[model samples]
Each structure stands twice: as structure tokens, then as C-alpha cells.
Target chain A: MSSHPLDTALKLAPSASAAGHYTGQSSPAYWNMVGPFGGTTAATLLEAVLRHPDLLGEPLSLTVNYAGAVSAGEFEVQAQPVRTNRSTQHWVITQLQKDADGQPVVCTTATAVTAARRETWSVSDAPMPQVPPPEEVPRLDLARAVEWINRYEMRPVAGVIPQQWDGSGDSSLSQLWMRDQPPRPLDFCALAAMADIFFPRVWLRRATRVPAGTVSITTYFHVGLAELAATGPGYLLGQARAQEFRNGFFDQTAQLWNQAGQLLVSTHQVVYFKE
Target chain B: MSSHPLDTALKLAPSASAAGHYTGQSSPAYWNMVGPFGGTTAATLLEAVLRHPDLLGEPLSLTVNYAGAVSAGEFEVQAQPVRTNRSTQHWVITQLQKDADGQPVVCTTATAVTAARRETWSVSDAPMPQVPPPEEVPRLDLARAVEWINRYEMRPVAGVIPQQWDGSGDSSLSQLWMRDQPPRPLDFCALAAMADIFFPRVWLRRATRVPAGTVSITTYFHVGLAELAATGPGYLLGQARAQEFRNGFFDQTAQLWNQAGQLLVSTHQVVYFKE
Candidate 1:
């Protein structure tokens, strides 16, 4: 069997001397307008943690900070378990890139909490949105312009896409169906990436694509391996909206749910935007 | 003029020798059921960044990870700018505690993004909920059980407080009016703490207070100094709800809005809870 493009993009090689350090090369297949897509970078960092020797249980929460520009080239990642309790573990991961001066600069910083989950009384307050099935919705046709957009099939059920920026909308909510183009099995890494796949909230609310980028994003996973495997290679409903957009920044809150109405992840991100 | 209890609790003395390290002593006034309240700990961490010599503009985003227990005593904090761009700066701050064996253990890890705000197209999609004025709302009386409760006055407008938990509600929403006791002026540090003031969503949804604690929290500040100052010791509206609760964990998303219906901060957190 051939390797998935995403797997090939996120594949990391360990350093011979360092235990928690890794080297990975950027992939043009997942390229965004600038550098690489933020979602792919988030997935790669979580992948580092998942592949760590000292990793504990599954990821409960993950936060990624896009500190600097990630140049398209080879980069290094350092993942370490900063603290470990009986059942929970905390990790700090950093993505480093060498500048023109050959000095290593931190491009991204992430903190992940992993713990062994136990059976408990479960409740979901945010009900799944009533929308048509993926088979009925038409896929967005952006495979020609955005490389990353081609990696996934997106079908919008509510709100307009960012490309349709006409500067006339007040609502920033977007509900859609999304999944890998090639139908890869659902997992924590892919879910982390999917959490960031929404367009900037400002773009949806203002209808103008001013300079905007996500400064930081946080995702909380509410499912385990069994639940994820049950999802298989299918579309997951995604909903995102902005609460406020002001003073050069805005916050986007989103949720990803499986077809079975199981909430997989809840994510929040702060984006930097300019007029 | 005397300093406010919150200001005193967040105050840190810079180390004469170390550039980015500081010493802080936890305050009993802000103590929770166990040690210091997680909100105050988050504020102290942000305070360290604010006091740093190399500090940049206001905070755009902040993520705090509760890695371990924060003992009630003096602790050390290290805040360093890992990446500095022309318009943005990224910092990594860690709260360190020495174990009985004198080895350093990571208690909390935080990442902060600070940047200069420029003119931008701003819009708020979330409308502030209509609630009674602060004078009309009665303050929750829980000063005897939680010391931190005494530091702030909270008036619930939506969900029931944990003390009133009778396991009767299926909704996890909570909207309340909150402000520092004695009416202290509003600022980023205060807003940061206020973001986490809401009770865990599980407590409101299940109506039972099991063993629950915040594992990680991320807050995005949408307003600048002027907007915060305009809020000026006045009561701010806080709204929080859980998206999903499953397998020993739950996630809370919250927002803080001024009396004028201006949104100030958006926050999200994952909590560890037992059945």
C-alpha cells in the first residue's frame, strides 16, 4: 500500500543523539497562500507528541501558537514531557527554523495534555446542526487556487466561504461537512488539523479578506481511540463562528462532530487581521 | 492609597541576577478549595510577562496549562521571549516548584502573544444577552467555603451555581455579572482572571460537584487598553457553556462582555472531572 500524502507530509525522522528532537521537511502538497497551512503544522506538532516514547494516554487538549513565519524548507521539532502525574502528562513542543543569519528561531510553540480516560457520565450541550448529508451537498471547487483546499472535500451548509468576500454580511457562523480527499481513517492528528480548517472569522463577517492569520489555536479532544475508529473514513460536521472582531484581533470558536452526532473536538483560535 | 488584593496577589519581584526570572508568593486571599485559584495563577503568569524588560505590546492570546499542583508558598516563574517579530512577540513562561528532593517540577506552562494593535475592520457577531442590571442581581454568597469567592462579586443570570446543584438541569449555559470586589479598575490581568471565574460546565450541567479541575485554559483578548479602561471597575457580563462532556473530561467556552455590550475576552478550557 502507498503512503498517504498527509502521512508523507508529516513524517519525521529522529535525531541520532537527541531523544525528543526530530527533523521534518515541508510539503508543497499542503502549502497555503504563504508557507504551509496552519492546520498541517498543528497536526505535525501533535504527531511529534504522539510518537514520543514517554507519551501518556491520548491527547486531552492541545494549543498551538504561530509565533513566526515558517519558511518552506527543512525544520526541527523538539517535544518533551514537562510533567507527568499518575495518569496525566504535560508536554511542551517547539518548531524551530533557522533564519538567514543561521540562528534558530522558534516558529511555533504547543502544549498538550494527555491522560488516560475512564468511563463517566457523558453529556453534549451543543446539539448537532440539522443539515443535509454530505452526499446531497456539493463540494467546494477550490482545488485550482489553494493547494491545501484540494487535500480535503468541503461542503458548506451555512454561511458563505471566504472566497465569496463581498463585504455585506453580519453573521460569521459557518457550518460545513469536511473530510480528507482520499478518505483516510479519522484519528487525533487529523482531528487536530481539521479544527483549524475554517476560514478566518473576519473574512466571513466582514466579507473582505484583509491580511489575516491565526496567531494561536487551542483544541480539546472529547473522544478516545474507539470513538475515532468508529468514525472511519467519513465526513465530519464542522461549525465555526466569531464572537468578536476588534482591535486587530478576533476569536473563532469551532466544533467538529461525527455523522453519529458524537462531538470529537472543540477548538478556539485567535486570529490577527488588518484593514 | 492601598493596593488591591488582586494586585498584591499578582505582584512579582524581579530577580536581581536573572533577567527573565522572578519570585512570587501566593496569596491566601485568592486561595481556592485546595491551593491558589487557577485564575489568579494565570494572572500572575501574565503579570510576569508584563513586568519583563523585553515586553512588547498588549496580549493578543494566552494559554495556561495546569501541569501540577501549585503549593501555597513562594514559587519561581521564568518568562522568556522565544520569538520576536517586528509587530509580534511570543513568550513561554513556566511556573517551577522544587520537590522534596530539590528537583524542579513544572507546575504551570504558559504561552503569551503580544502585539501592537493597528486600525482594522472590526465587527462583533455575538450579541450580549439581555440581563438585569448589577443592582437588581443578588450576589452569590459562598465566602465561607471558597476564599477566592470573597475576592469577587458574582451574580448569575443563567445557570445555577454549584452550591445549589440539585441535578435537575440538562443545560450547561451560565451567564453572570462579575467584577473584582471593592470595584478595582479593569485591566488585562483582571480580565484574564475573570475569564476563568465561571464554574466548570459539568457542575452546571450535571448538578453534581465531582472532582473537577481545569487542566488547560486559553484566552484571547479582543479589546485593547482603552476599551478595558472604559469598562473601569464596572460589572462585566460573563457567559460560559460546555460543548461536550465525555470520558472523565469536559470543555468550557466563555466570553466576557462589558456593560455596554462590548466583548472583551474569549476563553476556552478543558476540565478533568470524575463521575
Candidate 2:
């Protein structure tokens, strides 16, 4: 069933919203399959607008504009708040037909603004890479090139892996410890589902494959954090360089953290080189 | 103008039945800012039903999801047509605002589809790359930056180029052959106004100074040739590579052409990597 509803919305479920909101209380293994990315439908509509009970814990900063193509089957979601202020609370979501046409696709439209938590405030940090462990590294099938980031849960740190059976794929720009293996609670839509899992370091640094739509991307959020708690593991320190493809535009930049480093967010994009 | 009027109507201009459906009399700079992006508004109205006048020039494969922030002031654009097949034609666009109490707050919604363009097709002819001589280069000044992309009169077969320059840096890949230096016609909402001209190649490839919305951008618009008539000179090729940064998400790919090598449409985004 299209790869078993994406492996039941990517396994790892002890109780992370119990893998809910693929609609109909999840678990047919997430309706099993057809077309579900644009960051997994904006992280399943931010868990359907944070399971609104007037938006439970709040603290949202949702922004989705992945217009069209959800197609897997069984779809329906709704979140509405228009506007509210004590600090900030705005929401609007509507998906409706997983597509072929039940008709109703917006896919993503998020806005979360909340402020009022001061014991003192003012502390910016993230720069701590020195790793190892995750059951001693090893496990990255690479199939479907990790399907826009196999719905989270990655582990690799020991002598760094994925050298693809020893041919040594030349991988190093270290830092690993990611979460969502099943706990769920990390928000900002799991950093928009791990920013579409950095497309295999654009051909593992200098191997060259080139050609995939001008690749244009943008993510800018001044300072608004909170919603990351698979609890205990998550860190990704990496780097890459190629600053020029010329004339049609191709760009890059990256940084991510959380293993207890306390600086968890940074990204880059500009891919649109079509011929 | 702190920046709002529905963020300046996504860059204003609509009517004449939306500029007589994209094939004639266009340009107040494409009715004001459809290129050179930064707080502009309107056009999530699926470009008035995929350029309806019964669809023009035919060729479709689209993607646009810019979920929220969409604010500068005053907004309204709805656009519909979820299905229309016979080859194809799909549409959905929403950009709303009410917040202060009026209610609705959807701000940015997209979904576009339109087909029919027989070629039997295979792809790629490539060509176009021999820099120099757009009136002999040199004209990228902008009082320090921002002449609104020099009002569509671009000229870069590598002139006015500077990926890094203190004394004048050019770190690797740089291709510029721009158009409309008065010749007019930038076409297709001016390619989303140069899709965030990507911070001058992240400040001339780190010859130092980095700051542009941290990061998180995702864009994919495969193929849809033509519609770029800088009239005389036009070409923008700025490429970069700094292989993927884990967890937080980072990736790059860039390209945009017109000086006749052809390859007209391409764009991808996923940015917001705060460092």
C-alpha cells in the first residue's frame, strides 16, 4: 500500500501523539501511501493545529505554503483561530482531500507567536560537536534517499558511518544525535521535518550529480524557539562548500544542534538551476 | 510604510481582468514587484486562475508553498479552480488577513497546475555561457544595495559581480548576464523577483560577514520554459555549495537563464539557519 503508509508514518511510536493525525487516528501506518511530502504535509498539519483544545500548549510558529499534492488517501484537517492576543495566537489550516480531488488543498498556513517567559532571558548558544554512540553507529539504508528524512530518528556518531560498504563515501562534517524516534514533542514542526533532511549533503561533498530544478529554498526565523523534546538525543553538526554554479543560481548553508548544546536551528537553500 | 498594504499587495497590480491574462500589457514592473521579492503581496490568487482567458501558452508543473509572515499591511486574494482536466488545469490560491478582529488569517496558499504542450520531449540542449559584453558589464551599484534589481535592467555575463570583495572578492562560481536595463520585460512575476538574490552569495563566499534570515527554504518548479524577455540583456547565474547541515536542514542548487540558452524557470527554498 504505497510502502505501507510510509511505514506507518515512519514507525517510532511509543506515544508521540501516538502517530496521530494522518487522519482517522493514524496507524494504518499513516494511511500507507501515494504522495505525502512537502515536509510530510507540513508535519501532518502541525499535528492538526496542535490538536486544538484551543491549541493545547500553544507556543507555535507555524508557516506552511506547500501548495498541493498530498495524495495518499483519507485526508481531513481543520484549525482556526484567526487572531487572538494576550501575546499571540493565530492559526488556519485546511487540507481536506488527500487528492485526486475531494477538493480542498492549502497544505500549509501556520503562524505562531507567543511571548511571556522571563526569569531573566538572553542566552544564545549552539556550537558543540564532539560525538559517538547511538548504539555505536550504523543504520542508514539510503533507500528513496531517506525519503525526505525518514520521519526522524537518526543515530550515527562512531567513526562516522554510511561509507557505503567501505568504498569510504568520504563523509565528515560531523555531529549526530537526532530524535523523534517515537517520543514526539519537538515542534516548529520538527524543524519542518528536519529541513527535508539536507539532501544527502548534495552528493556527499564533491562527487557531483547536478540537475534538479533550480533548487530554491528560504527559511528565516529571527528568534522564536520551543518544541523539541524527543528527550535526550539530537544534534547535527555538518558543513559543505561550493559557492558557485553560475547563472541560474544554486546556493547553500547549514547548522543544527541539540544533545544538550542548546543551539538548535539554522538552515539554508537556493536551488533552481534548470535547463 | 513599515511594510504592509497586504505587504503591498504581494507587489501590487491586478485588474484588466488581471492584466488581460499574462500575454499582453504587463509591467508596472509586472504590476509592481513580482520580482525582487521582499514583503510583496498578491499572486497566491493562482495568477487569476492559471492565466485564465482560457489558459495561455500551456506547460505546467508547479510548486509554491510560502506559509506565513506575509505581512506589511492590508490583504485580500482568494482564487479558485481545484480541478479542470482535459489535459490539465488545477488552481488554488489564498492570501487573507483579519487578525485585528475581522477574523480570517490564512496569509499565503498555493497550488497550480496547467498542462498541454506537445513535444514528445526528452530534455536538455544546454548551451548559453560565454560571459562579458552586456554593454561591457559594470553597473551593480545600488547605493550599497537595492535598486530594486536595478529596475529590471540586469547585466551580468559576469559584470558588477562580487561573491566576495573587500578589495574585490570573487570566490569561485559567478555568472551574470542580465537584461531589461531599460529594454523592459522581465517576465513571470520577475522570477519571484530574483528569488531572494540569495544574499550576494552569502556575502561573497565568506570573505566574511554573514547574516540573512539564518535559513530554511525549499523550492522546486522543474520545467516551464519561456516568458523571460529582458528585451535585450538578461541572465542570472549564482551558484553555491556547502553540503548539508544535519537536523536543522540545509541544501542548495541554483540556476536562471535568458540570453537565449533558454532554460527559463527554476526555484527552490528552505532557509532559517540562525548562527
Candidate 3:
């Protein structure tokens, strides 16, 4: 398989100042309406930790906070292993950039937990949603969409798109079959990117698309490396729904499932919106 | 009403070193099986941010990473406002302690997003689970439970407790009605504590109570300050379920709702467990 643009965009090199710190540059290919795609940013942050020499096991949970805007420039990331237990390790990461005033500012903050796994009692309560096979569904045509939107091939399986809303539904539930446009190997970075691939819930509930963006997102990975490699580059089922929308903020919870009906990642995020 | 112990436990004194720094002492009344209860530590971290001199709006989301065990003595916390936008502000908090070698260690790391709210389109999709009212349900007797379990009055509504497990079910789901034991007023601290009050999901699914604890927890608060105060000391319904459990870890997604069937907070956590 050919190398994907995402790999090049997320590439990072060691920084001279710190051992676990690295410097990365943004790519125009993944630009969103405001800044770089949140998914790619999340993926890059996770990458910083995954590349750490002291890293242990796989990612169990990751939380990312979009503290500030990211301009099109170079940014420095510091990933540190705060504590490492016998079977688990915790990490803290920060993405820093110079503000217009030339002062250092934090643009993003993340915490991730990595732990070794042992076979134990297992079960899945959330069942995979019933949807037509990927071959039967039509791929979303995003010729005029943002550069980041064009990076994913999405096919809606449930709920109507914003433009197709008839103003009849009160719930903001959406299910789609999505994967990397140019099929990349399944790994932590790709799965992290897919966790934030869902559109804001507000767009699914309201006909008019008001300004909305995710403020904070937390994802819990269920599968390990073996399961991810088994799934390969096939399409994964994705589902998202809003639990509550109050005032100017709403909370969205989503799940990404492999084609074999195994849950891979579950994510939750709070978004800001305007009427 | 008199002051609740929870308030005294979460109280903080300003640190002389920095504007957003504080010195806090852990309370023995809230100790868990390990060190301090994770919920109280989470509440203390949020308290640090809420008590900041330059605080803005209410908390929309908070994620806390339990990096290491916190001793029962004293700890230093630094809560910095990393970024403040027009309507939103982001904070990064860290709890520091001295290790055996007298070096500074990070016991917990957290990121929170606070924002001002304006009236907008609102809806709730996750309906309150059907169960007996708080008055109808019997409060659990935890005379032999951990010190922290005595801090709240919890009444189970779904899934059997570990002792009640008949070795017949495979799914892990638990719903309960809970609140402060002495009827403390509803606020962000108490609500944050309640989010982690549920027993580990592994205990609920398996008859054996293995060693388990939360590694990371992220909560999204849907209501503002006024709504929290208006709800007062009333009982709040809480429900938690595991989506997938494998290896030595599992993830639990939970929700807290008011008596009016309004969703107040949605939380997710990844737990560490051993057989």
C-alpha cells in the first residue's frame, strides 16, 4: 500500500530541548474551517506518547482538550510519562505555539493511560447497530466539503444529513460507515482520528447549521493491537448521539465498531454551539 | 443546614507562590480502599480551578488522571488558565507530591473547559431509566464498606451487587439513586463525586471482587451553576454500564439525572482490574 498523506502530515521529529518532546508542522491538506482538523490533532498528540521510549502497553483511555487555536505553523509537543506502575503508565502531553504577541501559549492538553493486559472475563453490552452492508450504501459526495472532510469516506446509515432535515425529529442520533479515504493500516492513530470523525450533533438535529465545534473529547479504546491488526483497513461502523443539549453546549457519545461486530473505541465530547 | 464534611474535605488555601496555586490537605473521612477516594480527589482538582481568582463561567467538562497514589498528608495543586476565549476558558491542573527520593511527582493531572452559556436550542436524548422512585427504593447499608461509601446514600436500581450476584448474567449494568449522606446541597463538587461513586463494573458482572480501580475519568456537565443550585439536596438518579470488558481493563459510561428527568452530567471512565 502507498503511504497516505495523513502519515506525512502527522510526522514529528525529536526536539533539541527535551528527550520526550518533538516538533511537528501543520498541513494544508487537513485544514478545517477554523484550524487543522481536530481528529489529526488528537492523532498527533496520541502519536507523541506512542513514540515515547518509556511507553508501556496500549492506550486504554485518552482525553484531549482544545485549549486554543492553532495557526498554520510549527508547534512543539512535550509528552512525559508522569508515573509508571507495575502494569500501567500515565502520560501528560501539551501542544505549544507562539501567540501573535510572541508569547508561548498552550493550544492543547491531553492525558492518556497505557496498561498491559491479561486475559479475563469479557463481555460487550452495546450491540452493533443494524445497517445495510457497505456495498449497498452510497458514499457521501463531499466534493465541496472542507479538506479534512475529504479525507474520510462516509456513508450515512441512520439519521438524515443536515441538508436533508425535514424538521420532524428531536433526537440527534447518527450512524455511518466510515474509513480512511485511501485506506490506511488500522492502528492507534487511525482509530483516534476516527473517534472524532463524526459531525457535531447540532447539525444532525437542526436544519440550519449554526457555528459548532468540539471543546473537549475523551475516548476509551476497547481492543488491543492484535484485534486492530485483524480488522485491517476495512470499513468500521460508527455511531453517535447527543445525550443532552443545554444552553450553548451539548454532549456527544459515540462508538466505533469493527466489521466483525467487535467494539474498538468509544468516545465522548462536549461541543459549543450558537443559535 | 450545617456544613457537610465533603465541603471541609475539599477546602483549599491559597498558595503564596503563584496566583492560581493552592495547598490542600487530604481528609481521612474520604479514604478509599487504596489511598484517598478518586472522587474526592477529582472534586478537589475541580475545586482548585473553580477557586481560581480569574475563574470564568461554569465547568462544561473535566478529565482527571490518577497518575499515582496520593498520601494522606499535604499536596500542592496548580490550576492555570491556559487559554481564555470570548465565551470559553481552558484550564490545566496538576497535583504534586514528594516521592520517596524527595523529587516532585505528579499524582493527578486534569484538564477542564469552562464557558459562559446563552439560551439556545436544547434537547435530551438519553431518557431517564424506568425505576422506582428514590423514596421507594431502599438505601444500601454499607457499615462494612469503605470509608467513602459512607459519604453517600446509594440505592441500587439495576444489576445485582457483587454479593447478590447469582452467577447467571454476563452483562454489567448498574443503576442507582444517590446523594450526599447528610443531604448536602447539589453543586459541582458533589456531582463530580457522585460520578465516581459507582462500584467498579467488574465487580457487578463477576461474583468475585477482584482488585479494581479507575485509572481515568472524564465528566461532561450539562447544567450551569443556577441549575445545580436549584436542584438543591435532592436525590439524583445515576446509571452506569460497561460497553466492552476485555483483558485486565474495562470502560464504564454513566449518566446523572435530576428528579425532573433532566440529564445533569454524562461521564466515562476506564478502569484497571485483575483476576
| Interface RMSD, every prediction, one decimal place | 0.9, 11.2, 1.2
Provide fnat values for all models in the order shown: 0.89, 0.02, 0.88
Q: Which ten residues in a row have the lowest lDDT in candidate 3 chain A?
A: A160-169
DockQ value for model 1: 0.87
Q: Tell me how far the alpha carbon of residue A228 in candidate 1 is from the true structure, in angstroms, after superposition.
A: 0.8
Across A213-275, the per-residue lDDT of candidate 1 in tens digits comes to: 999999999999999999999899999998888878888999999999999999999888887
Candidate 3, residue B118: Cα displacement in angstroms equals 1.4
Q: Best to worst by DockQ, what's the order?
A: 1, 3, 2
Best by DockQ: 1
Query: Could you give the candidate ranking by TM-score, starting with the highest?
Result: 1, 3, 2
What DockQ does each prediction reach against the true complex?
Answer: 0.87, 0.02, 0.81
The collision pairs in model 1 are: none
Select the stronger candidate by TM-score from 1 and 3: 1
Task: Encode model 3's per-residue lDDT on B1-275: one tens digit a residue.
Answer: 65688998898999899898898888788999778899999999999999998998888899998888899888899999988988889998999988779888889998899888888878888989889999999888866878988888888888747666555556688889998988888999888889998888888777667788888999999998778887899999999998888888888999999988889999999888886
Q: Write the per-residue lDDT of candidate 1 for residues B196-253, one digit (tens) a residue.
A: 9987788878888788999999999988889988899999999998889899999998
Q: Which digits, one per residue and each the tens of the lDDT, describe model 2 over residues A99-147?
A: 4455455443433322222222123323455555455666445455424
TM-score of chain B of 2: 0.32
Model 2 bad stretches (over 4 Å):
A1-5, A8-73, A76-95, A98-176, A179-275, B1-198, B206-275
At residue B258, give the lDDT of candidate 1. Answer: 96
